[model samples]
Target: MHGLFVSDLHLLSPRSACPHIETELADYAGAHKCIVLGGDIFDFRWSDRGGHDQTLEATSRWLQDLQLATENTDIIYLPGNHDCHPDFLEQLEKLSQQSKNFSWQPHHLQLGNNLFFHGDILDAGNSLEDLQRYRRQFHHVKPQSQWAHRSYDTAVGLRVHKLVPRILHQPMRTCQRLQNAIDRLNLDDAKAVRNVFFGHTHVPIEGLKLNGRSFYNPGAGMKHMQLQPHEFTFERAIPASEIPLASDTSTKPPSK
Candidate 1:
């Protein structure tokens, strides 16, 4: 089945990923039998600590609605940098267990030599090392105990509640540099991979090739440049405003 690949939805971001926009996306996704969400579908960093469950429920409503519109369609979510928090994973695991059309893959997935991931592989280190780096950049990690991680995340949650739009293009550049380094690193598994689909970069680029392999970045589903007026900032969804959901302005699917 041909799959619709989406990335960087950042559902919690006020600057992007609004109800009307996601509803439009759901309409497009309904045309596909399978849906692969590469990463950052949800930005836990923006979740209100007190109203965390309410936030998750609100973000997931559109997904649930989409599933109903396209029965039997599989929606696979791969956690990205913005959604790698332990609390988010635990909630996702529960949702996947309860929802028939939903499932979660912790790491990358391979389909006929095509790799699907959140595009974090281009980072400085392995997953653990990356986690360490994440703690430093986003959260305050303690060497004392594993419990400290959770406590610090609570603090970080309130402090860093949204993505910094100023660095929006950084991930895109990093993805490009990583593409160049792939050949330099000479990793056999990487070489064997023919098609790589990732979405850490909010920049939408399709059919980009490097080192004879096809690379695609579905870009950020939520943070579309066309929707914004000036620079991308904390712009919330204005339903009454003149916001075209899709570039083509397609009709949305029935949110049954």
Candidate 2:
């Protein structure tokens, strides 16, 4: 099956949504059998779209439109720390009930031998319990001031956020953490999983192998000059030789 994976859009409103990339993404969705929204697709905590009710309404409407636009494709959404608010969860549940093509889970989605998640659980050490607790904290976050967003925009413009992560090798660290977390979980289908796909670190991984399993991250889509969502076909196996190392400074983006 053909699949498209993306994460960390951090969509606040039309102003920050990057409509051009979204247009491309919509086309990609139409062409794929399924699309997994890895997480942080909406930015509730820093949303400039208005207060809670307005932001929720806008995001909900956008989701409904996307669902309608991609009628034949399966849409699987896994909420990240930023978008896991209770009201958003309710909206996701309603959409899942109303649309056969739409579904959402709080943590991860597994299809065939591929696994997809938001990856926040691996951020501060590999702990599913910690991720849940962190997500719970998202419910209490109030929207930040305009100045905060401005400072963030400045950092992005200067590429500090991207550079720091790369220098520190955040992607490899995250992949290692994920491998440890997976082993501890001892999932019944662990043997079936071959590829692990995740986001939230905002570092794109073409491919990184650990313990015989491959990992990938599509990077963040939020006004960053990184690679966009990546497409994969489950029918074809990934070639190890073609994958680049995280240390390939000339080819890979900054880490984390």
Candidate 3:
């Protein structure tokens, strides 16, 4: 099925979220044949959505509504670092088992020639084995102090969140690191894969070719992050020459 990929919503408690995004996403789901939730759809560490159980409950209800609203669409969820809590994983697993349209994968998902992941594997010193191990440990980590979220929110408001990454050239560095990581892993489909789509850097990119693969990231749904959903038809393979170079297009700025 043709699909749209979105990530890094970093959804907090309903009281703090942007309700319009929920409506927008559901509308996209209805229009697309599939929706791939790339990762970090929920921010457990920053969620004031009550406690862990409450947050999961809210998440479950939200998913149920989305599913009901878009029964013909497929939902593919790849867990990101933020929402990999053990109990949350259990909930997703149960839902996947019970529902025909919903599915979840812990690490990476391959659909057609495109590889989808949360992009955590590109971290500075992490090996392939570290992926699941890190996620398991993340479950036990407590919520961040409210002050920390407040400070981050302030920075996001000031658009410093976008500025720092631009200054450091994080997107280019991330692309290089991702290429290295891919070579190191030597994925079974490495030779066949032509495109890699990921989220985690919170920086949106399109058609950025490095090391022979076109990379796409939809950025984040958090305020001022310029959230965008990418559409991909899982039919013909995208030729390298068909994709434009990143230098040919201006990167979308985070919304004010």
Candidate 4:
């Protein structure tokens, strides 16, 4: 399948948006292939504070155009932490119910020789159900109080961001750290999967061989990577190049 892989767009509205990415999505949608909304496509917490549907209508129109562009393209929506909201899930469900081109899978997806996930499966060990349950269990953060969480997370995220090595920096590990604490789980079974591609932690690695398998990530807030025709070539929108070991957090090229 011709696939367009992207993650962590963290799409917001008016004040914050990724128009180029959205445009690319439209172009790829016309190809009648596949688009993987890896994770963090929506930030529900932000929606709680900033309000929802600010950009959703525009986004829906884009998706509509995409579906109209091609008769066979499949747009897969995979949930992330921010996506684990009742209303958002409901929206996706309704859209999927309306057409075959749209689909919502709670967890990871396996396509042909490649495995795709938001990466929480390996890093957090939790499933979509787990995330939703945790959200439900938590005392709801009032709109007025939401800023506290964002501010705290931002302070921590910035600190961690500065500490991460340059090569592994785009994804900023802070999100995954909080997610792991919330899920309290981990899965070491990723090694069994071949050609695994994921988007959590936002760091993108391409053709980075490990344990006889290949891994690729498009990174957070970066361009989508395309897999088509055959040979896989990554056009990184960020500088997540496989670098010489710089820190425990940074990735390394396969040893010779």
Candidate achieving the largest TM-score: 2
Residue-pair clashes, model 1: 0
Residues forming the 10-long window of minimal summed lDDT in candidate 2: 247-256
Residues 78-109 of candidate 1: C-alpha lDDT, one tens digit per residue: 77776665555565666666766676666555
Model 2 C-alpha lDDT per residue in residues 70-149, reported as the tens digit of each score: 77777788888888887787777678767767777667656668888888776544455666666776773466678887
What's the TM for model 3?
Answer: 0.82
Mind giving the per-residue lDDT tens digits that candidate 3 earns over 1-256?
A: 4788888888873223355766776777654377888878887777876577778887888888888887777787887888877777777767876776777766666667788888987653556567766665556345567787688778877989778766654777888888777765545677777788899887889979877788899877766667777887787433223433212323211111
Query: Which residue runs of candidate 2 sit more than 4 Å off their true CA positions?
Result: 13-17, 30-32, 124-126, 167-169, 235-256
Off by over 4 Å in 3: 13-18, 30-32, 140-143, 167-169, 184-186, 236-256
> Which pairs in model 4 have colliding backbones?
124-185, 171-202
**C-alpha local distance difference test of each model:** 0.53, 0.72, 0.71, 0.51
lDDT of model 4, residue 230? 17
Model 1, position 81: C-alpha lDDT score: 74
3 or 4: which has the higher lDDT?
3
Greater lDDT among 1 and 2 belongs to 2
Clash pairs of candidate 3? none
Residue 36 C-alpha lDDT in model 2: 80
TM-score between candidate 1 and the true structure: 0.62
Model 1: how far is 80 from its true place, Å? 1.2
Score every model by TM-score: 0.62, 0.83, 0.82, 0.62
